[model samples]
Target: MSPRRSVADTLETRQRILERSLAIASAEGLEGLTIGRLADELGMSKAGLLGHFGTKEGLQLAVVDEAAAVFSREVPERVKQAPSGLRHLRAVCEAWVSYLEREVLPGGCFFTAATTEFDGRDGRVRDALAGMNALWRRDLRIHIRRAMSFGELPGDTDVDQLIYEIVGIMLALNHFLQLEHDAAAPARARKAIRRLLGG
Candidate 1:
């Protein structure tokens, strides 16, 4: 292959690896990603996989990054056109619900599974997950503050508490949809959100 073609091939292979890794991690937790298993699954050599990522932790971190990118595309990016403050907040939440409902990953939310898997552990993977979760919470806080300023929400609204409840609704939606196989969970979640926002 020409040098440019070789580079393109390498990029394609790396993307394929990360895509498969994200799916497996979403369903089975990051602990389930073994190089040998991936190699067998992809019909690639273990060394080739290792070359793509220098170590298992490296691969896990890369998968986490890919998951974050996917989330950005599915949720926040989809809501970018909404006017800021309450409208943006509502749009993003609906986008989140839709993303989960659509089953973007074979499993439910990748972060939900990852956080459960690594919450007790200490490592780069856990830190990366935590950072992403924190950023999400922070984004919610920003929207809440904006809504308050715009008088969409009461001035005395408990920002942290509202965020907690909103996140709780999404978590419950994921559980109901995935574990209980509840088809109405998304509607219920939207109802709860509207109730909380008084919309």
Candidate 2:
């Protein structure tokens, strides 16, 4: 009979592998994430790593899922206390910028990395990433709608456009910070969002 690995032990190992993979990817990009590299970093054998995740794609998917959970937990809480409107909008942008500015994903954002990495590729990864992007858009739109309802924005505002602009602002801030960590992109993003909302 095979020796049994406790469920808790299995989960801890999986979490470590996922976190290590994210750290590697964040530092070296997605292409740098390999079972061999992960095994080496984790002080485990390749076979042991493969026992946890059967393939590279499997590990990538798990990392994405973990990133998603982190995003969900971190982003919304920052804005929860703000009144719904320009403040809420600003808070959301600030929160997103903070999330990246702090390097929560180690690689900036796994979504940004995956989208840039696998956008043209045809497969499960691309599809899953596309869905995640869609979900983000939806969530941002909901906040925009709320802000609009609060009369914090122009009644003619388009949620779709606002969401895209906010995302662009985040991307701009991310790279700007990456290039010059001394530069305050989050504050700039807040300023730009204020101007956009006519605040």
Candidate 3:
């Protein structure tokens, strides 16, 4: 007879499935995830997997939510523990490159890959990514403003332009690391950030 699973076991099984799905989705875009593919990969039947997520969109949404949680834990949560304002902002930028360095997502930054995949598509997937992007931007800007409050940056700093530059550097860093497999991408990013911060 098959072994019986307790409530905790069932929950753990679901989490395991989601984690594996996250890894796959990290490498393959969400569109690459399908019920049949996941079911086969997880050794579960299509109907059994669909029991967890009613449809492909539902599964994609869950994966996006999980990705956001991972990013928050790895990036923003760690940044928050640093000194506030510009220090936090600096950490914010550094933590991102660090994330890519560690290959937290097998395909590089999940959001970066997702953005490229969904930027022009309109749907719940796009909404979810847009929401996460907005949250990151808000956090970055708040830190920059706080740094100004702490006199770390000039009072006249063009907040928008500064954020633009930081984000641009981060995008380039990801490209260098993911596309070119450059070992110095993170260091180059830090150097750029230091120059931008005037220190």
Q: Which stretches in model 3 have alpha-carbon errors above 4 Å? A: 1-5
What are the per-model numbers of colliding residue pairs?
0, 1, 0
lDDT tens string, model 1, 20-75?
Answer: 99999999999999999999999999999999999999999999999999999999
Clashing pairs in 3: none
Best-fitting candidate, scored by TM-score: 1
* Sliding window of 10 residues with minimal summed lDDT for model 2: 1-10
**RMSD in Å for model 2:** 2.6
Error of 2 at 151 (Å): 2.5
lDDT of 1: 0.96
Looking at model 2, the pairs that clash are: 26-107
Top lDDT hit = 1
Winner on lDDT (2 vs 3)? 3
C-alpha lDDT values of all predictions: 0.96, 0.77, 0.86
Worst 10 residues of 3 by lDDT: 1-10
Ranking by lDDT: 1, 3, 2
How does candidate 3 fare on TM-score?
A: 0.92
Q: Is candidate 1 or candidate 2 better by lDDT?
A: 1
